[model samples]
Every structure is written in C-alpha cells, then in structure tokens.
Target: MSSQAPPIVDDEECRPQISFFQWPDYVVLALMLLVSAAIGIFFGIQARRQKASTDDILVGGRQMATFPMAMSLLASFMSAVTLLGNPAEMYNYGTQFVVIGVGYIMVSPVTAYVFMPVYHRLALTSAYEYLEMRFNKWVRLIGCVIFTLHMITYLPIVVYAPALALNQVTGLDTYAAVSIIFAVCIFYTSVGGIKAVIWTDTFQVLMMFAGMMAVVFKGTVDVGGADFVWQKTVESGRAEFFNMNTDPRERHSFWTMTVGGSFLWIATYAASQAQIQRFLTVPTEKQAVRAIWINCIGLVALLLVCCWGGLVMYANYFDCDPLISGKVKASDQLLPLFVMDTMGSLPGMPGLFTAGIFSGSLSTVSTGLSSLAAITLKDFLIGAFKMELKDSRQASLAKWISLIYGIICFGIVFLVAQIGGVLQAALSVNGMVGGPILGLFSLGILIPWVNWKGAFSGGIVGLVFVGWMGFGAQVEAALGNLSYPKKLLSVAGCNCTTGVLPAPPLPGSYPDIFPLYAVSYMWYAPIGWCITTLIGIAVSWMTKFNDPREMDKRLFSPVLIAIMDKLPLSWQEKVNWPLKPAKKEGCENSGFEFEAENEKVQKSEDENTHKF
Candidate 1:
C-alpha cells in the first residue's frame, strides 16, 4: 500500500507576477460585496416590521421562496473549497474524482423520505433537537458538540482555499484575502440573517456559473475546441475512469468515489445542519424537498463543469505540466493561473472570475456561521441557560453569536494549507468530524435500542479513530511522506529550456504506513459511521434498551419502520421489545427521563407516542 514520493521537476513557470490584475476586477469584487450588504439590509429592514423573531433571522421566517433555497443550498455546498480545489483535483488526479457525484445523487431520496419528515413534523429549530427527543438532552448535547467540531474544522478551510487562490491570482497576501472575505461575509450575514444569505446565495450562484462557464468555454476554445480538448485529455490519459481496483488503499476507485462517497454526501447533506437549515427556510415540506432535489441537480452540474474546467486546464497545459516546473506553487493555483493565462486580456473577466470564487466562498462561510450560530443558540446556549428568553432576546443572541463565530473562524484560517491538496485536506477533516455525527443520528433514528450511553461512548471512540486516521494521513502528506499513486507526465512536449523531466526524485524508502491511515479520504465518513453505529448498537444492547415502537415514531427512521413492518410476525415480535416506562420518581435517571421534570419528560416522550 506504500507509495513513492513524486519526483521533483525543475521550474520554469514559477515566476512572480505571472500577470497583472485590472481595476475592473476590483470593482467586480467590490460590487459583489456591496450587493451582498444591500441584500442583508433590505431583509433586515423587512424583518424588523414583523418584530424580528428568532425564527425570522435563523430560518427566514419560513417564508423563503423555493428557487432561492435551492440556489443557496447548492452555493453553500460549492464552498470556496469546491470552487478552487475541485479543478485542482481534476488537474492533478484526472477525471476519476468526478464520479464522487454518484454518492451525492444517492443521498437525496433519503433526505426527502427519511430525515426531513421527522424534522418537519417536529418543527425542529436545530437538527440536534431531534437527538434530544430520540435519546435525551445529553445525547443532543453530544450531537451539538460533534457538529460544532465539524463546522469549526470546516469553516476555516472554506476561507483559506480561495484565499490561497487570491494569493496566486493577484499577489494578495493570504491574510489580506482572508480578512476581506471575513469582513464582507460577517457584515452581510450578521445584518441580513438567513433571508439575506438566501438571496445573496442566489446571485452568487449565477456568478459562479457565469465565471466557471467563461473560463471553461473560453479555455476550451483557446485550446482548440471541445473535440480538441477531449482528444488531448484522452491522449494524455487524463480522461480515464472506472478504476476497478479493489485495494482499500487506492484513492479514487469507482467504489471509493461512488460507494464511499455516498456516505460523505450523507454527512455533507442529509446529516448536515447548513443544508437542513436552508431546506426548512421554505414554507412547506414539499418545497423543502423540492429544494433538496434542485440542490442535487445544481451540485452535479456545477461540479461537472468545474471538473471539465480541469480537463480544459489540462488540454491547455498538457505538456507544460505546471506542477513539475513549479509555475503553480500549489495545485489550487492551477485554475487561477489558467484563468489569468487565458482570460486576463478581457478587463472585467478576471474580476468576474475572482468575484465568482469569492461568491462561492462567502456563501458557504456565511451559511456555516449562520447555522453554527443557530445551533449555538438553540442547542447549546438556550438550554444551558435553563430558562426561556424572549423572542427578541433570542434573535439578538443569534446575531451576536453569528458575528462572534465569524471572527473566530477567521482566526483558524492560519491553520489552512496545501496539505496534500486543499480539497483532500478539507474532506478528510470533514469526515473526521462528520462521520460520527451521521452515525450518532443514524443510531438515534434507526436503532430504537440505542441509548444516550452507547451514543456517547460510540461517538467518542468513532471521533477519536477517524480523527486520528484523518490527521495522520494529512500530517504524512504535509511532511512529504504519504503519497497516492497517480499518472505521471512527460516533459518531452513541454516547450522548455530544462532537460528531460529530472527522473522523479527517489525516496529514502521507509516501510509502509498503517493501512487504516492509508484509506482514501473518500472513505472517512463511511468508516466513521460504521464504527459508531456498530459500537453504539453493541453497547446499547448491553444496557437497558428502548423499543422503537414505544418511542416517538417521528424520532426513528421511516425506512426502518417500513422494513420492520414487512418482517414476518414471529421475527418482528422477536426483534422488537417495549421500553420500560419511568419508575415512581425516587430513582436515578438513566437519561431516559430527566431531573424530576415529570411534566416536561412526559411531553417530550409520551405525548409524541400518543400522537403517533
């Protein structure tokens, strides 16, 4: 499973000021931020007349139109990471990575049929609230904590990816780019709330499509045409896919991208708060589900364009191999370099493209900040305060939390880097944090026997294992240790002064690293989920388990229930058991009931059961 370090090639394209940026570009970026601010102000003003409730700021008062939610959902998913890193992924690894979208497509139906129904029926303000109902407040807290870790690790990378791109594009320091993104993103998001986020996301989505299209089409034409690009790609072996390799350590085989990626999509969408929050902004469950479908379609289309843009980049630089010559400092720099190389002649084109990148980054960061803020207020703070606050107070709290979180996120940007590649780095971190979360939730919704105890234990163990594996791999990559097998390029056709690509440098040759750590980043979520679910189920069975039938039907999975119903009567009776009802007030709580609050416990558990 061990891989050799890539041979380092001499540099020719690594020059300072590869191109100069125009004034129109600045204006384009400026106008995009200004428009973002205006959208926030307008939404803020409208919300005030309605007394600006917490729901208004957090979920757009559940008055958001369909198209906007769809756009925002996809834009948020398109993070600066995706905008810049996706192209880099294709440019380096080839098009096999694009098949990851199959995993994405697989998650949509589950979101519509399983996860959304419970949240919608319960009117959940926070996704973790469902955890509290299914297990206990303690379990909800575990979910909240895991989600916070996920967002904290993720949001910083979101800011850093485009900042790295900006550094390459405009000679802007990463600090300056990070600061500028933070300011605009914080201002608009804090003022406007979710509604502002939605509308701005819509505009940004268009800019994203426009910018990507311009680069792709223009670059394709410059390289010859669509046919020319395809011929070059296939000839270069860059168009290859269907890697039937069964090696668990193989990075992007079909199973890894589609099967492994399917869980990442679940972690990213079905189990994610940013997406679910956007979904709930619409008025009806149907509209929310519609948004989910729209999001899937848009995601595939945008990602495919970005992937093709990568191919076009390859066609244009087929022989040059920018990475070998050091023209590109990082893989992430390839796309920006290509844009400047091809479209730099048009005055506003660079601006439009850069703004387009910022658009994707801003939308994602704002969405995360807003969602994290809501989770903080609803899941963490409000409950911790042990009392209800006024609607106005709650709304104010959400805004302040969002503002503060945005600032905190910026501080983490210093931690971002080209560890391997930004795309893989971000996803590995996401899997580390998100896998256990999806597992915890999956346990809550499917295995009625799972209790807070098993959830807590499983979550901690799963997080530790996945987190360890993810960071170990990243550290190795950062240290030039772990290497993934990839197609090599030749300098024979590169118009260069340098001699034949210096034989790729040989390594000191160390022993193989752990296979667990070598599993592709694509498998992180699935592994994490499996660990947590399996361990959680075992631990729950060892303790006092609840019968799903005795609990709120909404808290469990509709799919699980349907399957259970179809089982033979004898098997169903053998597999299911009733949860023991609460004892007469003198006993210690096993987290099934809480703090002698009989009325509240009854309302949360028994009431829902009665309704079902």
Candidate 2:
C-alpha cells in the first residue's frame, strides 16, 4: 500500500471519451445473438429427426461430449454477474479477491470423488432424487422447491447485469434489453433442450474469453503496458495480494477466500441442479471428472483476465476515479465505462464486449431453465404426484415448463435491478440457501445414521440460521451502517463539475450489531453446512440411527467407504460397518420408510457386496 495520494495530473489524451454503440458494434452484437439462436434451432431439428426422448431433452440422452459439457458447466454458473461484476469487484476491493480461484480448484476433487460418483451411479434426472432415496419423497420435494426458488431469484440477476452494461455504454433501455435476451434464451432452451443449451454455452464461453481478453489486451496497451498498470495499481493501494486475517467479519481475506469460498463452490457444484444436470449429460463418470477439471482451468483463466481488467482500469483512472467524478453511476458500470473510454472508437470492439456480457447471461438463463424443467418433471410431476406419461409427452411438458420459468425469470428481473453491488449481492443470496442445500446432500452421503426426520429438521434449521444472518447483513449494508471500505479513489483529474464522493468508512467505524450478522458473507455456506451436519447427527442419535448393516452402500460417498475399508478392523467393528447381516424385525426398519420398502426388491447380500 502506497502512502502518497495520487497527484492531480491534467492529462487529456489519456482520458479521451469516445461515443460507442455504433453500427459496427451492433452488427457484432447481432451476430452473436443470431449464432446462439441458430445453435438452438439446429439442435431442435436434430432432436426432431431422432424423435428425442425425455432423457434427450433434459440431459442430452446421457451421452454428451466432454468439451461442450465442460464449457456449459462453466458458463451456467459464471454468468454476466461474473463477467461484469468481477472486474468491478477487483476495482473496488483489490487482488485479495483473486484467492477465490483457489476455491474453484478445491471444488474439483470434492465434486469428482464425492458427489459425482453417487449421482452418476444413481443416474437420476433430478439431483434431488438422491434426497428421496436416502430419506423420503418429502426430502426430495424440499430440495426441488429450494432449487426452484433459488433459480427464480438468481436468474433475474444474471439477466439484469449485462442489460446494465448496455444501458451504461449504449443508452439502451435495461428492461427492454432483458426482455429481448430472455426471449432468445427461452426460445432456444425450450426448443433445443439441454443439447442446445450446452452447445450455445460453449459458443458463448468463447465469446466471453474473446471479449474479456480484448479489453485486457487493449486496456494494457492503452495504459502504457502491463508493467505500468501493475505499478499504478500498487501505488494506489489496489494491488492487494495477501491478507491472512482469520476474522470471519474481515472480508476478502485468505481464510475466507479458500475455506469459506470452497464451501460456496462445493455447494454449487455438488448440490445445484444446474451443474448436476450437466455432469449427468456426459457418458461416464470419468468424462464428468475430466470436465470438472477443465472447467476449473477455464474458470481460473477467466477470473485472472477479469482481475487484470480491473487493474488496467485502475491504471487508466489512477489520477481520476470515475465514480468519484460522476462518470459512472454504479461500480458495476465501471467496466463498461472503461470499455467505452478505451475501446469505444475501435470498430466492433464495444459490440464484441457487449456480446460477451450477454453471452454470459444467456448461458446462465438457458441452463437454469433447462434444470428447472427437469426438476419439475422428475421430482414433482413423477416423484410427488406419481404422474406417468409417454416419452414424447414428457418432453413436451418439459418444454412448456421451461417456457413458463423463463417468463417468471423475466418478471423477477425488475426486482433484481433495484439491488446494488451485484457480485456480493448475488453471492450473499446464493449462500443463504446454498449452504443448507449442500448440507442436506452432505448429510445423506456421509451420515448413514441420519434419518428423514433428522435430515428435514437440519435443513430447515440451517436455512433459517443462514438466512437470518445473510438478510440482516444486507439490511445493515442497505442502511449504510456497515460496509467494507473500498480501495482508495482519486478525482484529481476530473474534467466534469461534480463534487468528489467521500471515501467509505473504515470497518471499525461500522455500527455495532449481532456478531453473527457482521460475519462475512463468504462464511455462510460453511456455517450452514456445519449447523446442518451437527444437528442432523445429534437428532438422529437421539431418535433412531440407521442400522449400518441394513443401509445401502451406494448411498454413502465412495471416498468415505474407501477410507473406512482401510481403517483398522477394530475401528470398523466399533462403527458396526461390514458387520454380519442381522435379521430385520418388521418394525425395526430405518426411519427412512422408503428404504424399508426398497428392501423387499433389493438384490441378494452377495450381489450387493460384490457391487460395492
């Protein structure tokens, strides 16, 4: 961190403002939209030719290729919120935020080894089906309902972000742009299904990379070079690389990024229907595992590019902050403002950038719509109501369901537009429910003792606990009683006649509140996971624990089972694992009555043992 404030430097050539959103930009943007729609149409034709089944419509018939699957998984969650909000995060916070990439790295193995194997073996359309298998239908419905609500709240924010960018650079009506984007997404997603969503996502991910790299490349060159950008950022106290603080209330620390952040990613990859459906699209577990690693690599690369774009923005505005000078209305608009300032004059550059932002939103919404359809059909229509239908009818119903969800998402966009600081707001909302959802899945996989009663109780408690803290923090932030201080800003070279905005108050100056409310949003997932797991185990013990010998091994995580197999014989005996099969008493079944019914049709003990 530098001690000297940035000097007042009157430099005109360096701060040239150019009008963007011209004909060339429009052509480039229109090209992306057409290509995305075309992909959906092509896949729709292919599906019709083959007379695709519900499996084909929802999960690509469980035979999708690896590369596209990997890209779709990456694009689905890393939405415009990621592309537009992350650069702003870097600009407002600092490099300490980059440690979140490490969280992505940690998620790969956890998903591949733990969650993937269980889901792959089950081969269910809805990931929530595992909850029912482990507990009962009520648990599965709870998971489905949570996911539906999550996507409803989340998709609107994803769509609104790029619309905000267009409003900033092109003066486009935000809701109008959102409507157009959602219409295209709904058309392709409903027509082409998962195949169309995955292919379009692959194309959009390419656009994302191209657009982000173009900004980074042009911004670095325009700002004098990478070296100058680094120097300026360091001098302005914005090149923060390491903050080892362990305090939960301290935002963007190494501990929060790796530990708490890993929990966030784990919840996303392990439990979220959007990612799980993509994982099941591939032919085998190995391909899904490979795709997870590939997605991790791409994600890290994209994060680095977005982070560097922030540094480049800082370098260009080192002596004149845009927000302080009233050049940009919101932090989320800083990237678009920088794009227009630097690359606006270049033919198609601004359009290419806008296309990339829209691509992120498109991939996300399409995936959400597809996943929502699957959850509705598999978990609710079939699992809850026991509806039976032909494969073609099921596919038709799914498309209609997806169309309805798209419209619902469009309506939610108006609400999301009112929220500020998209990156944190998005993450905070995700963590509030995401933690408990992950905890529910984790309980089923790791704790054989947990019954339906315990699982349901723990999930409800975790959701309430995290929701209380997350919403309280948001209210405090809304009221301006709490905020993380941003990196220093300067308006020394402002050419406009606006008053300088005051620096944010330090964390110490924040109003007192419940300590839990002050905890960083990063910890929400871990906190939810812990509360659910502990309470679930305690409740199960107090009621009726599952008989280890009677429980199905496939429901347990392979990693846990493998570790137990290698444990000392005495330790295994103590846990009552690999024990002699006891004759079942008619009323002594696990509180999971679903499992009890399954016992009658289950395979022989030797067959089950051999399968494990």
Q: Name the best candidate (by lDDT).
A: 2
Whole-model lDDT values for every prediction = 0.78, 0.84
Q: TM-score of each candidate?
A: 0.90, 0.91
lDDT of 1 by residue, 1-612 (tens): 223333454444334345667899888878888998899888878877778899899988766778888899889868777888888878767889899889779888988887876566555678877777676678778778888877877888878877777787788887899899899889888888899999999999999998899999899889999998888778766686798777777777888998788888888777788887876676566777777898899999998999999889888877667766557767888899999999988988988888888888899899999999899998887764465888899998888888999888888777754443768777777777778889988887778778778888888889899889887887776666677544545545554434333332232322278777677888889889999998898888898776555564555566777787788888878867333343433212233322223333223332222210
Model 1 quality (TM-score): 0.90
Clashes of 2: 0
Local lDDT at 428 for model 1 = 79
In lDDT terms, how accurate is model 1? Answer: 0.78
